[model samples]
Target chain A: MTGDGVLAQALRYLNDPLSWTAPGGILDLTGQHLVMSVLAALLAAAVALPLGAWLGHAGRGAAVVVALSNTSRALPTLAVILLLATAGLFGDTATVLAAALFAVPVLLVGAYEGVRGADPAARDAARGLGMPGGRVLWQVELPLAVPLLAAGVRTAVVQVVATVPLAALAGGGGLGHVIAFGMGTQRYGQVLAGGLLVAALCLVVDGLLALAQRFAVPRPLRARAAATAAR
Target chain B: MPGNPWFSLEWVRANADVLATRSWQHLLLTLEAVAIAAAVAVPLALLVGRRRRAAGAVVGTASVLYTVPSLALFAVLAPLLGIGRTPVLVGLVVYALLVILRQTLAGLQSVDPAALDAARGLGYGPAQVTLRVQLPAALPAVVSGLRLATVTTVALVTVGVVVGYGGLGQLMFEGFRNNFHRAEITTATLACLLMALVLDTLLWAAGRAATPWLRGRADGGRRAGHGQPARASVRAGTGTDLGADGRGEAA
Candidate 1:
């Protein structure tokens, strides 16, 4: 096909109203993608955050933390998804689990490092102020750790969004269906459009998370960063 | 029991040859992708390292490339590159660039300014200073990046099964496609994970051997306190820190 034809076909597929209107249309698929991605990220954060933070605060299980994080990073996510789907977990569940598994390492590492890396003087001052250990953790450590936590969450979310398309391979539904369908029928236009949408969604989410990370920084730290930038 | 297709000992015994071939394919694919990615990422990072001003743009582009979905990228590349090793190789190479590039840039930039000054004072020219001092200092950091990229690429190479070029991934896909055969799927999964661990360990060993000074430095910096060991460039304490990123403060 000519370059112009390829571009025209992709644009036509994207601009078509029908692509946005159905039970399985682009809009619907996008919603599915978002739901799967968000749920998986939330699940990962739920498990990773408390455990990682506690481990970091206790200063124990450093080996376990390192091993777990590395294992998660090294897991072949698509393989896991296929295995899970074939294992009878079924549809979106397998996808979500795969995405969650993919997300856990980054979030876990972030939380662990964020808490462990906190300024000891500030932590000590909190203890000296007669604050309970739990109170110190909540009021002092968590706030300071927010920026790293946000960064981790941002990375996790983008990864999950990108990964959810793999679900289509397992007969799970999402934007990947478009690409899969296009592939089956040699409809390069649909494939291009679907891929672009997934990429665009990732970038949009990345931008939002960057903004959130900016806001998550403590005021003093933000001011310091600003000062440093100015210098 | 032999009646069970999914998890039969017989099935695994029968598929030994399949496993070996697929594992070899996976290894070759991962090695090629990482090699290409390093070739591209190092020079680009070196350029950015020297310029400093271009670091943001280079890293940003790498990030965007990383954000592209692996499966989608395969689909897009398949029509152009044709379905086989080429598309998968391209996709894996793309995925690797971000981590490797970031680490290289961070490593090169992290070279001590005082050392650079000393080199200059000692009559070293710009190229000499970069070649003699900066590159040596940055080696550990760059190796750390390579370790991360290598592990990640191993994982990603499996996804190329979608385009019919996955190494062990293809075996796993076949297991799934052919009626969820338990033994086939389970064996393939184990093999994939095992390969990942083995490869990661190999790279880890290489990093250790390459940076023997890290251990000595760790001993020297022990008394300087909690964070100082990590900040000491080459140290056992800094190994994990280096594995991720260069910033000692951020972890």
Candidate 2:
């Protein structure tokens, strides 16, 4: 219970290779966390699209979506999982829903803003070129909005990946099992070790995104400005 | 749908004291975490913003922290700290780093580099330049980041229920646990929503107040014509500090 005891024990757990080599260890979590994280990002992006993009583009009654997103933002993942899980949904569905909800408001805000903030002049020019509204949205608007979409997806990835550990609480499983076990046993070393491991996972995912994110950046951002200048 | 447990104003009114007490406790928890988060994040952000490579590394670290699952983080912390405010506060501080670092970087980066050179030419040392020029220029972004942190912390602090700290989350979780439909669930849910709205508005106002030069009265036309000051640009569903640069134009 003392800080010294806890710190020493925690370090011991982290340093012990046997813990990992043992039957159920960090490796068990890798697959599910990966699945849940990606699923969370995809679910957040998908939900925010029509709901966020339409609201962003439509230009009226938009506050409703904003309000809803904000409201979702208010509800914590614990509250949502507890509520939904109690209603009979469990495991992956519960984790995904919790992660998706955690992600939605922020994702929607990005989607909405990215769409609304799309260069008006660019849209006008695309329309002038005879692009239909749908074509304009798909070709011009979405292209320009890709960065924002990517940005939202990136946010969801981090949020979902980090938070999926929460699934363990409801028996959904992930690094959360490590975390919850550590807590339940009053094993401070195990808790910090679990936390540190989860935190490391977050860093790896973020690093992967930094590289992957460039693909989502708008084409204009990618074009060498000097090359275009020379042209 | 038929039961509609949360719709009765009279029922909620009867428990106004309980609801209000929980709201205040929730608010206090949020404010405490935010205050601590700002203390650590702002200073660190200023320091990192000076070096490009370092900033990237720091930002990378923040992303990892920002996305941490609250349930697990708290669960991990709770056993060591053994429940209640301390562990939760620590988590919020970590969460704030994710936003604060990225936003602070954005604000600092956005400053016309020319301005810094001018300050240097005027004989400002690195310290003077940072305190006077860099910090001021970055203030708007800093405040915006703070706002995002505030909104986010307010939302997540509700998870403090996992540790049995007992705030509005207690009501929300209890409602969920007992299947106490409308009265408990309804009351807690509405309180959370209202608190979120109120906290968001307060943070938005705080951002504008902090950065008057950015939201100059002339920009009143911008507000009237466009929308509210694009404070934090948090894309609700996603967990990235992406808004830091997403609508750089809007910010």
Query: Each prediction's TM-score against the native?
Result: 0.90, 0.74
> Model 2, A173-207: lDDT tens per residue?
77777766775676767777777788778777866
Candidate 1 accuracy as TM-score: 0.90
**lDDT by residue for model 1 (A62-98), tens:** 6665676667666788778877887789868999998
What is the C-alpha local distance difference test score of each model? 0.73, 0.67
The deviation in Å at residue B177 for candidate 1 is: 1.4
DockQ of each: 0.46, 0.29
Best model number under DockQ: 1
- Model 1 chain A weakest lDDT span, ten residues long: A222-231
TM-score of chain B of each: 0.84, 0.82
Q: Is the docking of candidate 2 incorrect, acceptable, medium or high quality?
A: acceptable
Off by over 4 Å in 1: A1-5, A223-231, B1-7, B219-251
